[model samples]
Target: MQVELNSIWQLKDLDGLNDGLYRVLQLYPQDQIVIVFPLVDSKTLQRPIKVGFEQLNEALRVGKAHLSSYELPYYQLQSEANISASHLAKRNEKYSLIADLISSPRFLLDLVEQPRIKLVSLHAKKHNTYVQNLYRVLNLYWKYGQEKNALLPSYKNSGGRGKSRVAGTKKRGSPVQLSCPSFQAPEGVNTTESDKVLFIRAMKQFGLKGEKVRYSRVYDKMLKEYYSDELIAAEAESRNALIPSYRAFIYWIKKLFPAEKLIRKQTNQGDFDRNKRGLRGAATDHTEVPGSCFELDATVLDVHIVSEFQRNHVLGRPTVYCVVDKESRMIVGLHVSMEYASWRAGRQALINSFTSKKEYCAEFGIEIEEDDWPCNHIPQRLLCDRGEFICKDAEDLAVPLIGHLSIAPPYRAELKGIVEHRFNILNEKLVHELLGTTKGRSYIRSDKDPRLDATFTLREITKLLIDEVLEHNSSIFKDLAKQSALIIESNLPPTPLNYWKVHVEAQRHALSRVDEAHARSRLLPISKVTMTSKGIRLNDQMYYDSSHSDFNDWKVIARNNGSWPLEALIDHDNSSFIYVRLEKESGFTRCNLMRESVNFSHRHQADILFFEDWIKLEKSKAKPTAKSIERYQRRNQVIKSAKEELAQAPSLDSKSERTNGMKARRREAILAQRLGEEKPELKQENSFSEFDVYKEHSDHKKQKVVSMLKRKQVERDEN
Candidate 1:
């Protein structure tokens, strides 16, 4: 009565399965012919298989069509019956005899007239339970008098119905649906929501990593389109809920957006933190070869270098970016620049890393040999943090310069832990002991702490930093396991001078010009031609006679940046955007969409701005009255910062600082930042040293801006 099905190929052993069948004179002389097979495999029982009986009989072979993976096989039709090979194999001899007897056509025809045959029982997980349940519910709803689309069966509202059984709605007549977070990210969790982890995961699933940059704009497009759609269950972003302290918000925003910046954090907990002390954790090293990867990041000067440039823009404190071969921990490029950190600075880091050039050759009083590093096989990967200088726009300066560029995962500073940990050690052993009686400058104030001043300044600090780096490479880290201060063979395997020696002659020729340009070129100054509403013009001279043909119906704007390698801009006649002509590319590239949604946003902004500007104009036009608009200016800057942070997902353990400038392959990151540094601007200005002084006096600037804004608010309130 019961049998199991197994591999169909076993049927080849039976004469009943032969393609050219012979009518043998049987002793039973039965009319029906039956072929029985037993299930001997789990796969056969789990799924169904259907093979054309005629084809199997004709082929007489165990091939693809005659044998399918799905094994649950049985057929019975007028005077004929068949069972799977698995079933036949599993059946008892008595059942085998019955199968032989049923092989007669007469018996098969008679067996087909029988009312029914039964299956013994179904096994667990063999059933599609959810689909079955769904079908059952649908059948019952249709068969019974259950009202269509109603949450409850045969229930009525407003008449004589029992109280409803669900949250938010009675279960009687109304259809009920519940809204919840897509996943279980907390209601106020800003990190998960804004970081687009789910979206990014989907991208990874679909192999859309590189495509995300372009597709992300599509998402922005969608968000704008659905701006008015009801999105409930969202927390009302507030200053109080998020803005823990001014410091926290500043920290949060600093890590958002073009979220790469030279990071400087000190972790003295060394090899004792829960992380380092934990078990043999996931051993993560993407390097396939010893020197395949070279990671570089900059830390604040544990010690500074004195300014040596003619203009002598005293760096005050010098910083250096060191490239370390992950496997050997060799110093590839060791560059110590003054106060300026530019996109060019990042290129210098990369170039110096590979080529190992030195600006301080005279100071060292030695001509270091070139490294002659392999040119054909560039480092497989460049590892960097999100820093303005490194990951400047779409081109991602570091990535294109090498084969692959991998960002240190957000907050998982451990991925680049070597660099980070080394910096930490530098801070502890070198920077800490070297402060001496000298004082480091207070970032928050212009004045130095008397303790700090007698201790350290620009010259001494820079010198100390240089010495620390040299000492760190020349000594420490060779034996971290060693406790005592002892001489060790820690060394820069390939010095800056030696790096260039290994580079191939062809590579030398190819990158020689470009590399030199990268080093010394005025990156931010380049030539460009533009047209006003009138026509195509370069430096006010018309290049094209009139805006016609290619120039016809195109408007242009002067894009200012690099003063050489001329570029131009053109307006599109039909599209909702403009285009740019670059130094290399033949076609004009398009820009961000300022379309219907953007127009709508602008209009909405205009309404609010109109109200604001109106209020300002009205304040100038007329004096205050009892019902006058109260100027609550500068009331909640701290709160605004909190809101922005709260708009972010919850903090991961670490963060970075970066700026959004043009996503160009080559840019002067020094000047390539949004004019508004996403910070509340103050009246403080210094034309040449504006950015420099602001950075130097950041804390003082912060305090002054906060105070000045409050004062301005009070003055407005008084009027």
Candidate 2:
């Protein structure tokens, strides 16, 4: 057998030689002898041995020696990807020195053929000691497959990594430095086995628990529990010198307990599972395609807004509900209203998502083509938080529109991170810069109030939000867009709209259509409305009228049998119309507010409710005023005066007399009251007419008297 360079040979039962592995460094074919070196520690320099080819072949045939290929250990095979920049640079430097020695065949053969000691002496004389032994370089080159990375230092074995050192009398770490020159630092103590036990006990007692505890507190507890009473009674300096320091305790605690373990133990199980745990998979991994899943979430906007009707009246922050597609990260639907974050508001958002966007945008005075914002279908599954989508009503409505309803566990916002993150984007991109924005106001002390700065009405803000949504949907989303295989194949820019369009064209979407009216009726919140004699009363404030055939009949029945309640679906965003269900089997009947409730037309239920609350507040404020008190006092006085008059008035002698001339007495009293109340000026103007009437009576009497004894002179005295 011929001995080849860089071939490792293990001698088993060789006489007069220790059995070990050796590498063939150089071959001398003319002499039939090979130069070989022991593959031992690179730090030790060993002279190469010359072995005859016949002798190696005879040993191999006798099974006393074996030929084996050299393989690098796992730790020695470091890839460039895993290497740090500094370590890689160091490795490259080492490889550069020996690059020619390993690569050039003639130079390597001539260099390794020289006598080993003479070679080392020559290298040392030339000051070219990149390695301790030139023969060891060849040994490693042969051992690790002759790669540039083969020269990398075994840093993994340095610094006693992952090994605990035995405690001794001498200190192990840097000495503590005192901040003040006058202060004396405590003498360091080696962390003994007992101290490690104390640290473990303290960490298990305090640090590793649901409630977060300070390391300082844990150290104190350990010192109190483990230190003897005599040690505790010692001076602070002496006690610290005898016992382990807080820093030592911390070092051991960290060594025993990893950061992840401590964090898991110190945080709530839900919080840890939701936020601190590693994300093994993505939301898109579960959503197979666009519209496969929609995430719903609502947030109170940072900016204050005014009422649509009254711009000067700040309506406070409005709740904005957003629906995001899990696969494409598109803002499929949105609802902004003064209503609080409730199922009612979230339902409107879902309805908006399921219906066409063209008409919805038109309502906000924004004109756009169908393709500009073309997310108008129900998703196969809906993922949402426990807030709005966990209720029975939501389950009933949403489970039908979306085939599956996924209610995320409480406190896990990451489950609906798609929509929750959209809210942050909306606030950052659009809301934070708007007038009356409350962002950063918490830390500001300026006299300017965000509420007072509110200039945009609810409608104006809604329009702006629609425009933002359009822009956001069209904007390029680098992370989400580039993740799509279809978009990459099509070489399209990764905007949400582009991604959605690509998938839709490829028929890789799970969107389904539902009747708009049916979706609206099912998703809108349901409430009970009373059918009264006057009209259908809603919330006992606004009344509605339906033109159905049974409307009048229901009204008649209600009037005769007292007010009755019927189930109705209300769109909280619009108080103008409500869908009323008169019968169990019948569909929802559209009802408009009665004429009496015209004031509440085109208004939100929140606005009407707020107005009612404002009115109540005003009444409450007015009730305690001086004028109100005086009015009540006057009313009491009138009652007292009427009681006094009744007491003074005479009683009828009999019931028969009281009824005998009731009509004549009433007429007389009315005539007396009219005369007493007549103005003086009117009385003077009528005086001449009265006198003329008296004169006519006298003349008539005189004429009659003349016929009767001529002259009684009608002296009738006009009597």
TM of each candidate vs. truth: 0.29, 0.63
Candidate 1 lDDT (Cα, whole model)?
0.38
lDDT against the true structure, each candidate:
0.38, 0.78
Give the candidate number with the greatest TM-score: 2
What is candidate 1's lDDT per residue for 1-719, written digit by digit as tens?
11122223324433324331111111121422322323332222211122334533544444422343331111211111344444334333223223333344443233233432221112112342333333233233222222222112222244546432232322222222347646442223233233344334432343233222333453444333332232321234322232112232233334432332111111224322434344453322444333467777775554433222111222244455666665434455555554244544455556544533333332333343332222222366667776533344414444555657777654455667656666675677666565332223444566543333234433344345445555454452433222111112322234322222222221331222234333222222233555444433332322333322444334433332212233533221111222344326454443333232232121111123334555578789896654443333344666788899887956545443232334431333443354445444442343337656655675575667433335344345554
Q: Cα deviation in Å at residue 41, candidate 2?
A: 20
Worst 10 residues of 1 by lDDT: 20-29
Candidate 2 positional error at 331, Å: 2.0
Quickly count the clashes in candidate 2: 1
lDDT tens digits, residue span 236-289, model 2:
445443777778887888898888889999889888877789998776788778
Clashing pairs in 2: 716-719
Candidate 2 residue runs with Cα over 4 Å from true position: 1-161, 175-187, 211-214, 228-240, 305-316, 337-340, 440-461, 489-491, 525-567, 581-586, 589-598, 614-719
List ranges where model 1 is wrong by over 4 Å: 1-284, 303-317, 338-344, 363-378, 389-396, 435-471, 474-719
Report residue 609 deviation for candidate 1 (angstroms).
38
Error of 2 at 220 (Å): 3.9
